[model samples]
Target: MTGPSAVPPVTVLPVGGHGLLVELPTAEAAEALHAELLRRRRTGTLPPVREIVPGARTVLLEGLAEPRRLAEELPHWRVPPLSRTGGTAVRIPVRYDGPDLAEVAALWGLSEQEVGAVHASAEYRVAFCGFAPGFGYLTVLGAGYEVPRRASPRTRVPAGAVGLAGAYTGIYPRSSPGGWQLIGTAVDTVLWDPERTPAALLEPGTRVRFEPVDSAGTPIGDSADPDIPDPDIPDTPSGSREPR
Candidate 1:
């Protein structure tokens, strides 16, 4: 609120036996701080840290050798504003046809085609990954695009079902019960491949753009923008990403 509070007062608390929870006021502040901690860990300046897990408004520091020392030093850690360059981007092809497509269009006072255009045109980022493995909580590029979940939860949402919830969009990695507003479905992409190098295609801080596809699974839009492929995704199958 009020244009991101002054340096979101961080509250460090014991998370578990070997972890500490560094809380922030907003998701933006938390993500920025998580990036900073991750960068430090990559450079070997971090104190014996094993993992830096980012949440909506907190960063969980796990496998720390000295949790108390890190907790004491966390307040001094400076967090920068999130930049578009803060993370890697992955292109995902989607077909704009879900059970909730018409409902979502009506919610935003737009036609199904208009909704598809608006949705595909915006850039998104992985705010965090949870609820399900390989499922990412993606922040919408433009505001006023939030959609509420369904009145009744679906007992089995198929894998690759693209959905929107609150201020974020998500994809179902496997058949499971869910209540998010379904808007589309990604084409032929493996949301999770245990055999792949990076089992999860999406990761926290990763940028994502949903490219629209047609009934034949052909990419409707011309091409991908800012076509810098993420190397970490590994040899993905067809329909996930293609040559620009």
Candidate 2:
């Protein structure tokens, strides 16, 4: 069946012994299928599987007892476009002073301040989580905010660094090498905590917004204090690469 874009049909391929990789034409379509799978599984209509991992344009289902049977059935299941507004809302305070902020502004054809304004105005969703434990690949609801990755990969990117690459915006969970364009730094946010229930602050399907703030934890361009709550939990050290 055709996906949300309706340009191409869904393709399911066998992965390893018990996994099936379902590919779609677009990230939005993948999200739709992922949501549908979750709904069916919750309602006891889907087959048993160990994991359903969503990616930019694909969903990887692992631990299937009958991969070939499910693969044949996946192409016939109709899934609607995911609702952009559905998900848990999270606001992250960012200090727009990254090393690559000026570069990103020039690419966007806007001033440094305007860049922050534009980036902060968009509502983003966690399309998937990969590369690192707490790193989430966040995508905007609409189009036209794409950015190219850095020409040269950095030897080390500090934890809390907010970056943009292609259609995704991600934060570095810990210090590691990366190529994403750094646009800002998340303030008073713990990206990963082993002690936390979910460990990662940003999970797949979570809605996110960036709130521009200055030093001392006050909202920029306004007198009101956002009173952004501190994560307060100790971070777990990780050597994983930054999320793409």
Candidate 3:
């Protein structure tokens, strides 16, 4: 039930012909606004809109019937801090054998084993979805872990690669060029499946926990089934950049 002390100020701007972009001070504030909008829409109190997109520090409302009025009213709306409970929980088993594990350990002043333990110990939430269709920008709750990207971007970061950049962690949905610091590989985690109901496994507000597993797929310090089906890796590369 804990939340932010005060609601952050929002600046609503017009986007093209039928959109209003509400910019916030931080990603958490933006998520709060997005959650509020969704709640209003579900209650039939919000105006009709085609899409509501949450970004790093902004929420984009597209296909609004009254963009101008909505833009004016958005500034006055009190957006409560995002609730961290009652959301879909996803557990991802990760193999901490990434190429940049040693580099990340050096940056965090911890051993490679400690790095995995620290990462798996924290709970993360999907703040937003961007970079790719299935790629989600996950923020650690009550944690300030930050890491710099690679000096030179990789030509092709394989699918399932778990990486960190800035204050977020993301899994690559497909092979793509990226600069995020890779720390592990999500085992048998299918981020995007066209045939699935929502396609993206992780969405905004989804709670996630990374479970560290050995090379033989045994969970560390726990006994549980890790029989999730592996996703099919495509040869074609996606065009989206790494999540910031």
Candidate 4:
């Protein structure tokens, strides 16, 4: 296998209800495609396609036209190369004082500080949008961090919980139940009313950096990078913006 032939061909399956899955060769490749799809959606250039879902190494394009129509139209869908803009990095403040923090650090054969260092060092890309609105499933962590989910699930994981499960790291967007190994807590107001011009905080192309916070979980102002834009998530406007 070489070049295009080596890569998984895009397979358009029968829309089993609303979506069809296509195998992607690698997580990086899938993330690059995911970013492209999101940009298209936001810019209104997406070719009549609806939701573009991403998995470990695959994407599911939902609500596309009939298979025959897609076969005709998809050839024109300009998928940008994987090496295109890796997009902006977001440095999120986190308190490395969660209930499961000790256990997770121990599993990685490191002290608490070492664990936090490992989490803070990586530039994790937003691999997909799922598990909830605005929640981003980030890719593999840097070396020395290979943790798994909790043996049993938590009744409720607070919104902004920074967790690790397998090779993936995730941020809990809303207050919800989860089983992932919680190493810290973040305070990003990720979700906002769609009335705002740009709603979600973590888009597909957005990269992430985790900054350790104080024991009280308050942002200590020690940011990894202070230049990233504060995503314009909005509150429910007082009739200022119209619903879509």
lDDT of 2 by residue, 34-81 (tens): 889999999999889999999999999999988888898888886755
**Global Cα lDDT for candidate 4:** 0.67
How displaced is residue 33 in candidate 3, in Å?
Answer: 0.8
Which window of 10 residues has the lowest lDDT sum in candidate 3?
231-240
Q: Write the per-residue lDDT of candidate 3 for residues 19-122, one digit (tens) a residue.
A: 99999876767877889999999999899999999998999999987798888888889765567666557999999988999998888777897778777776
| lDDT of each residue in 1-244, candidate 4, tens digit only | 2354233345556557556675555565566566677787789866677677777787788886654565455434555555323555677888777788789868876778656766775556677778887887786464445677788899999888888887778888778999998888886456434776577777666667777768766655444443432222222112222232
Q: What TM-score quantifies how close candidate 3 is to the native fold? A: 0.85
Candidate 1's TM-score reads 0.84
Best by TM-score: 3
Q: What is the lDDT of residue 76 in candidate 4?
A: 47
Instruction: State the displacement of the C-alpha of residue 20, model 4, in Å, after optimal TM-score superposition.
Output: 2.8
lDDT of each: 0.79, 0.81, 0.81, 0.67
User: Which tens-of-lDDT digit does each residue in 1-244 have in candidate 1?
Assistant: 3333444578999978789998987676787788888788889878987778888889988898778888888898765556665445788889999999999889887789767777777667788889989999987534456787888999999999999888888999998999998889999888788999899999888888788999898888554333432212222222223343
Local lDDT at 238 for model 4 = 23
User: Residue 115: error of model 1 in Å?
Assistant: 1.3
For each candidate in turn, the TM-score is 0.84, 0.84, 0.85, 0.73
- Model 4 TM-score (2 dp): 0.73
